[model samples]
Target: MSRTPHTKTPETAPAGGKAPDPARRSDRSRRAILDAALALVGEVGYNKLTIEAIAARAGVGKQTIYRWWPSKAAVLLDASLALAGDAPTADGRTGLPDTGDLAADLKQVLRATVDEFNDPAYDAPLRALTAAGATDPELAARFTERLLAPQLALYEDRLRSARAVGQLAEGADLRLMTEMLLGPLTYRWLLRTAPLSHAFADALVDAVVATA
Candidate 1:
């Protein structure tokens, strides 16, 4: 799949409970490694991508990458999350939008998610992560923690708020509601059944409101 290299800045948190050396994190080198890793993995696949290959494309020493990340998964995870974060959901707020309108807030976030899915930069790495996670239990856990969990946490917060305001029925299961919103989106992306779009997101929000 032909795609542009991702240049969005990655979050600084390291995998495996360690911090990267500050000196190695200069803007140029960081973007180069991330772009190289994301592109190569999309081309050669996760099983075939190597630190040496990444370093060669990035024009940096293999030691430079290893000095920061423990493994190739760590580098790819960071790169994936960085490009994925470019989605400015949450009502354009830094977090989940708590604008007191539950349906609207959820729709906004879902639309942003759809947009991210459509972007080639975010699409390849995210697909790679999910495919790898299917076979690798440990990678699945780390991917959830470093990527998926934070987004789910936002949904949980919004749902809880809706319950407090009685937008949701009394004793509504928030976990299920979160899945209700996400499941269609995830299924569509996975199957390529159709283009993920704001129209679809709006429809989901409307369905939730009507059924609630």
Candidate 2:
């Protein structure tokens, strides 16, 4: 499958000022490389994927990729971030959809995430990546650091907001609560334990809110 180049840009500086910094332009090429990596991994499992393949697919030279990333796993980590469309802000925070209604906000984001997780375009590649990470310590660490931590932080932020507004009980363990919300869905999906449906999500929200 042909890959779509990632063109998502960071928030631009003031209009008509000096164009983006040279480093920022380099970042764009890095994003493109990542996009190619994810697409290739998704299309052809991780073991078969190579630095050369990613470079060719990304429209960059092998050295360009090697200059930024030491290995295919590193490229995949960046690709996962690019595919998620999340780049951390200057303050190290990645934004999550905040509609002020905690349940609504969480449910909306989770539903969209479920859709992405289930998409053929995303599922195969991620599954392959996960499998590779299971055996590769370095890749696993990068996966946790780059792909998983940011998402968990977003959930933690939302839970904190809910606590502030009294939607969640005082002294709630945001980490545990976040896990409670995610564990079941991931269990079902990763293990094929059962179907993941809207009903399951609604029930999850209800159960979690009641505990909060």
Candidate 3:
């Protein structure tokens, strides 16, 4: 009898146990890293957030984080994007709520944003990022490019759709309109100067659409 040659497949387990799926393991680690980043940002503030702290919190090595991301800010940015539903879809569309009533849609989204800002879960981490970004140019650029710009683009898309339907002026400055509509909410939330509410959201929408 001839001795058989042993072949191991990718799915083959070791002698004593089942094979570990690298993809699933990576996904779990990614989720843990993001969750740890978010929780630590809220607890310690972005200024004090560190790779080591995040790694410990995530039960991962600091090198594991560095292998995936360049810095703590990058890690936090990924966490923020994962939490925020503003990322582009697989088709590369913003997927903003457009029910043909731009004003209603705008109000709806803004109101939800207001609620998020009011929730300590979201508010703390956001404040930490915002405050740190204000002082750190590199962080600020990354925050805007990765986190804020996508959201702003979503609003612009909605505004553009409204413009197409004559709900907005032909010469309507979509970018300016977007800023005008969202700028106040951001200011009030970041500055803690005033309460954010559905009514405030409605007012902002009304003000922007009034120019149509």
lDDT, candidate 2, 25-139, per-residue tens: 6766787788788888878889999999988987888998888788887778777776676432212344666678887777776676677667776777778898888898888
Global CA lDDT computed for model 1 = 0.81
Mark the 10 consecutive residues where model 1 has the least summed lDDT.
Answer: 8-17
lDDT digits (tens) for residues 69-135 of candidate 1? 9999999888877665656774443578778888888887888888878877767767777788889
Which segments of candidate 2 are over 4 A away from where they belong?
1-31, 86-93
Q: Taking the candidates one at a time, how many backbone clashes does each contain?
A: 0, 0, 0
Which one wins on lDDT? 3
- Each candidate's TM vs. the true structure? 0.81, 0.78, 0.86
- In model 3, the clashing pairs are none
Write the number of the candidate with greater lDDT, choosing between 1 and 3.
Answer: 3
The residue-level lDDT of candidate 3 at 154 comes to 83
Error of 3 at 145 (Å): 1.5
Q: What is the C-alpha RMSD of each candidate to the true structure, in Å?
A: 9.8, 8.3, 5.6
Each prediction's whole-model lDDT (CA): 0.81, 0.76, 0.83
Give stretches of model 3 more than 4 Å off: 1-17, 86-93
